[model samples]
Target: MLAFPRPASSAFYRPDIDGLRAIAVLSVIAYHIGVPGLPGGFVGVDIFFVLSGFLISGLLRQELLATGSLGFAAFFARRIRRLGPALMLVTLVTLLAGYMVLLPDAANTLGREARAVVTLSANHHFMKHAFDYFNTATDLKPLLHTWSLAVEEQYYLLWPLLMLGAYRAGGGEKALRPTLLAVLLLSFAACLSLSYSDMPKAFYLMPARAWEFAAGGLLAWLPLRHSRSAWHANALAGGGLAILLCSIVLLDEHSMVFPGWVVLLPVCGTLLVLAAGGLDPHHAPGRLLGSRWFTALGLLSYSWYLWHQPLLALGRYYDVGQRDLLRDFLLGGVLALFLAWLTYCLVEQPVRQRRWRCFATDKSTLWAGLAMSVLVWLVASAAMYMPKKYPWPGYQAILQVKQDQAQLPPGCDMPERGVPLSPQASCRIGPAHAPLQLLAWGDSHTDHAMPMYQLLAQAQGVGILRRAYHGCPPLVDAVPVGEGKVRSWCLNHSRAVMAELASLSRSGLHGVLMNVRWNGYTALPVAGSASITGLAQADAQGNVAVAGAMLAGVGQLDRAHSLQVMAASLDRVASQLAALRLKLVLLAPEPEMPLSVPECLARRGAAACHASRADVDRQRAAILPILQQVASRHANVRVWDPIARFCDAQTCYAAAAGVVRYQDQNHLTASMSRTLQADFAPLFSWARQP
Candidate 1:
C-alpha cells in the first residue's frame, strides 16, 4: 500500500498493464534465483512481448488514423529514448564489474557480449555461440538475459516498417488487423516447426517469436475496451487469470518444448485479460493489479529487469566455499532493487521524460542516444582485447588448468559439436609398430581416462585402439532421443564400433576396455538437472526419428524397462567379446563432482572441492546393478569400480595433494587420469596375456 505520484499518460494508458509488467519481471527474477515451484516463470517474457505489441501498435494506429501517415523518425526516436539509456548504463556497469572480478577469458567474453548489446544483436551473438538458454552454464554469463531485449529491439525494427506499408497500401488504419493476423499465423507456424527440431534457433530468433508480439497487436485493433456488459468482462477476466496461473504452474524447463503450440495458452490468456479491461476498478483482478504497490513496482519494472540478471550472474561467478542459494538471492535482490530505483530516478526518467535540454527535441535526443551508444561500444572494445594485451592476475594457474585437459592423440579426439562419429575410424595410443592388445571405447568418459590407458599401453609394450563419441554410449540399437546432431550420430557410431570390435578380434586384439557416463544416460532429471534417455532403434544411418512426445511422461516403470534394455545391450557386447576369447573390462561410473575442480581450486582449498558421497551413491544406484549383472553373465567380462579410489567414507574428492583431479563437473583432467596407473595396470596385464 505504498503511495507513489502518477506519471503523465495518454487516454489509452492502463495502470493494470503496468501491474502485469510487475508480475512479468518479478517472475523472471524468481526463476533465475532458483525459486522452487515456478519453473515456467520464463513465460513472463511472453507477457512482456504481448504488452509491447499492444502498446506500440496502438500508438502507431492512432498516428495513422489522424495524420494518414506514420512519422518514422518520431517513432524511432521514442524507441531510442525508452530503451537505449538504461541498457547502456547496465552494459557499462556490467563490463566494469566483469573486468574487475571475472577470469580473463570470461571478462573478454563479457566485453564481446557488451559490444553485441550496444549493437542490438546480442541474440544473434548468443545463437552463434550456441548458448543454451536453459543450461546451468548460463548462470555465469552476466549479459545472457539481454538476448530477449535484442529480440524486442529486432522486432521494433521490422514491425514499424510493416505497419507503414499496410497503412499506405490499404489507406489508413483499417488494414492493420489483417496485416497483424498474417504475421501472427506465419510466425506461429515457424515456431511450431522449429521448437523440437531446432530449439536454440526457435528460442533466440525473433522470427519465431514475432507471433507473440503480433498476438498483442491484434488485440489493439479489436473492440475490447468498448464492452457494455460488466458481467461478461468479469467472466473473461476470471478465466484469463485462471489460465495464466495454470500455465505458470504446469510448465517446466526440463521437459517442455517452448514457443510452440503450448505457448498459445499464455498468449491467449493474456489477450483475454486485456480484452476484459482488467484495469477496470470494478473487477477483482483489475483492482489488485491497479493498486498502488503493483503500479509502483510496474513503474520500476524496466530498470529492475536490466539490473537483476547481472547481479545474480556476477554473484555466482565470484562465489566461493559453501553456497547458500536463498541467502544469495535475498542479498542480490536487495542490491538490484536499490540500484534499479536509483537508475529509474537518475537515468530512465530523465531520458524518457525529456527533462534534459539535449533531449528536449526528438532529433537531438536521437543524436545524443547515438553518442552514448558509441561510448559503450568503444569501452567494450577495450575490455574485449585487454586480457590479450596484458597478463591477468593468476595467469599461470589459469594456463595450467587449460593445459590439464585430456590429451587425445591427433585425429583421435571426439568432436564436441558437429561432425558425426565414424565407426570405421580408430586411433592408436602406443607405438605404431606395437601389436594391438586392448581396444578402448565408449563416450567422452573413455576419452577422459585415456591418459591411464596410454600409460598401461606403453608399460605392457602393446597398442590400444581407442574409439569414442561425445555423448553416445556403447549400447547396440539404443540412441539418445532429443534435438541436435547427437541423436543422428549415436546409433551409427555404436554399430560401427561393434563391427570394428569384430574385425579387431580376428586381428589378435586381446581385451576391450570400456567406460561410459552411466548415470548421465540412465537417470531421469533430478534437482533441475537434465538427463538423457535412449530410444531403441536399428537404423544404420541413425535416422530413427523419435517424437519428443514418445519420451514424455516417462514414469518409474518406463525407467525400469530402459534399464532392462541397457543390461541386454551390455550382455550382447560381452557375449561377442567372450566368443572371440577377448577379455572385457567394464569401468564403473566415475565419481562426478558438483563444481569444476580448477574453478574451485583457483580460489579455495582442495577440501572445499569435493562431492558428497551420498549424492554420488544416489546418482549411480540404478546403473550399478545392471553393470554387475552383465559382468556376471560372462567369464571374460569384469566390472571395475572406481568409488574406492576416488572417495573416502564420507566424500568423493575432486583434488588430492595439490593436484586438480577434474577439468569440469564430470570429466577427469589428464594429470589426475595418469595417476590411476595402478588401477589400470591389472587390466593391461590381462590384455597382454596370450
Candidate 2:
C-alpha cells in the first residue's frame, strides 16, 4: 500500500481537490436530472465522504501538531460558518416555494423534512420513514439530498473530539493511525453485513459510512514519498478517473447491493486521486483538474448542490409533460447555476467575510445561525398548517366527502393486514339486534365497500359480519405469493377467514359477499411458466399460436392459470356455503381509474378525471369473463356488475354527480361507495323477504 504523506505545518490550497468537488457535484446533479449514461452518478456522495475525511482530518492533525491541542469551539464555529449560511438560505427558499406550489399533503411532508434537515437528523428521519433513496417518489422530496449533509455534519461533531483524545494519548499520531484503521475495518464489516439485511441502515446510518471517512483520515496521517516519475503519477490519477467513470457508467439505483462492498469502487478511486495529486501536483491529471473552468465550478458546487434539487422537485411537482422533459432539464440546470452564483456571492461570501461584524464572534454567529434556522422552521410549520386554517373550496369539498364516507358501522376499522386477527373477531354493520344476514370476505376491495354494505344492511334491517384481509384473496387454496414466496400473513389470514365463514354460516348467515382485486392474481406469471413480459409481448403481437405453445410447454392451460385456480377455489367455497343453505354474491370488479381521482380533480378538474372507455374495457376484459364463469357454475352464486353505474359507452367517470368516485386508482371512496347502495336494492330485498 502506498503511504500518504503527513501534512506540513501550513495548509496549502489544492485547486485539483476543488476540481474533484466539481466532478462530484456535477455527477449528482446529472443523475438527479435523469441524464443518460450516468446511472451510478450517485456514488459522487461516496467521493464527497472520502474527500471530507481527508481534508477535515488533515486540518485537525495540523492543529494538533502545531498547538499540541485541538480547539473544539473554534473548529465547530468554523464549520457553522462554512456550511450554515447557504444551507439556511436554500432551506428557507425551498420551503417557501413548496408552500406556494405543493398540495396539502405534500406541503406538510415538506415541512417535516425541512425541520429534520435543520436539526441535522434528516438521514434518521428518512430511514425511519423507509424512504428508499433510489425510489421514484424520492424525486418529489426537495430536501432528500440533505441526508448526506446531515451525515457529514454529524461526523464533524464527533470526529474532532475523538482526534483530540487520540492526539493526547501516548505516541500521538502512532496511536491514532491504528485506532482509525480499526474503526475503518469494523465499519466496513458492519456495512457489508447490514447492506443485505437492512439496506436503510447501510445507506443512511453513520456507523456503516464511517469507514470511508476513516480511510481518508488514515491517508492524511500516512507518510508519502515524492516520486519524480511523471508516468507513475499520471497512471495512478488516470486509473482512479477510469474507475470513477466506470462506476458512473455501469452501476445504477437498481443495484440492490449498494453502499456495501460496491462502494469501494468510488471510495478507493477517490483515495488514489487524492494521494496522487498530493504527491505530484504538476502531473497531467492534476493540471486537468486544476483548470480554470473546473476550479470555478468547484467554488460554486456547494450552492449549486443545494439549489438544483428543489428546482427539479418543484418542476416535477407541476407534472411537466413528457415531451418537455429534456427542455425542463436544461432550464433547471441553467436556473441552478444562476441561483448558485447569486447565493455564493450574496450569502456565503458575505457571511464568511464577517461583513456584519456585530455578530461576527464565534459564539454570536453560532447562536445567530441557530436562531435563523429556528425561524425558518417556524415559518415552515405555519405554512404546513395553512391548508387546515384556510382550506381551498375544492379541498374542503373532498374532505367533507371523505368524512361522510368514513361513517362506517361499528368495528369497521379493523387492524391492518399482517396483524393477527382472531377467527371470531368480526365487524357487525347494521341493526344491533338483527341476526347476521350477510357475511363479506376478501381483501381491501371488500373494505372499500363497507359504507355501501352498511347502507344496504340498515335499509333492509339486516346485519353484515365483515371480515377482510387486504392483499389476500377470498380463495382458500390460492395464497398470495410474490417474488416466488408465499406470503405467510396472507396465507394465515385466508385460513382464518375460512374458519370464520364456516362458524358464521352455522349462526344464521344468509349470504357471503366475495370482493377482491382480481386482476392482481391474474396478472402474475404462472408458476414454472414463461415470464409475464415475454407472454405479454407475444399476446400483444396477436401471436396466439406462439403464446399457446409457450403456455402448453409450461403445462399450463393459459397465462392466467393462477386466476383459474383462484376461481376454482372460489367455486369450492361457494358450494360449501350453498350446502349450509347460504347464498353467494361475487361482486364484479369496478372500473379502475387511470389516475388518482382527488389529485386529478384538484389539478385538472372533473372533466379530465374520467378514464377513456377503451382503458376501462382493457382493465375489465380479462377478469370479467372469469367472474362470469364462476357465477354460472354455481346455482346459488349471483354476480353483481356495477360498471354501468359509474361508466358509460364513452368513458368511466372518476367523479359522478359532482362527487369523486374513487379514493385512488382501484378503490371506491367511502362517499362514492355509499352512493351505489341503490344498486344493491335487489340483494337487500332478498334478505328482507326472509
The prediction achieving the highest TM-score against the true structure is 1
Q: Write the per-residue lDDT of candidate 2 for residues 1-690, one digit (tens) a residue.
A: 112211113347887788888899888888888888899999989988999999899889898888989888778778878888889889888887876666667788888888888888999988765345775556667888899999988888888888778777755777788778988999999988767556667889888999999998889888876788878788888989899888888987553367767899999998998888867877899899888788778878888889988888877765521214575576457889888888877777777767766248888887877887798789778767885566544466545544444454444444545446533334677888877778778878898888888888877788777777765676655544322123345655666666666776777777888788776555433211112211111122222222111222132423366556666777777777777777878888888765556666767787776788887787778778877887788777778889889888998898877677886567788878888889877865564333
- In angstroms, give how far residue 579 of model 1 lies from its true place: 7.1
Taking the tens digit of each residue's C-alpha lDDT, what string does model 1 give over 519-615? 5555345322343454444454555544543342244214565566577778887887788788888888888887666767776767777888998
Q: For model 2, where is the 10-residue window of minimal lDDT?
A: 529-538
What is the total number of backbone clashes in candidate 2?
2
Cα TM-score per model: 0.85, 0.80
Instruction: Judge candidate 1 against the unseen true structure and give its global Cα lDDT, from 0 to 1.
Output: 0.76
- CA lDDT, candidate 2, residue 125: 87
What's the count of clashing pairs in each model shown? 0, 2
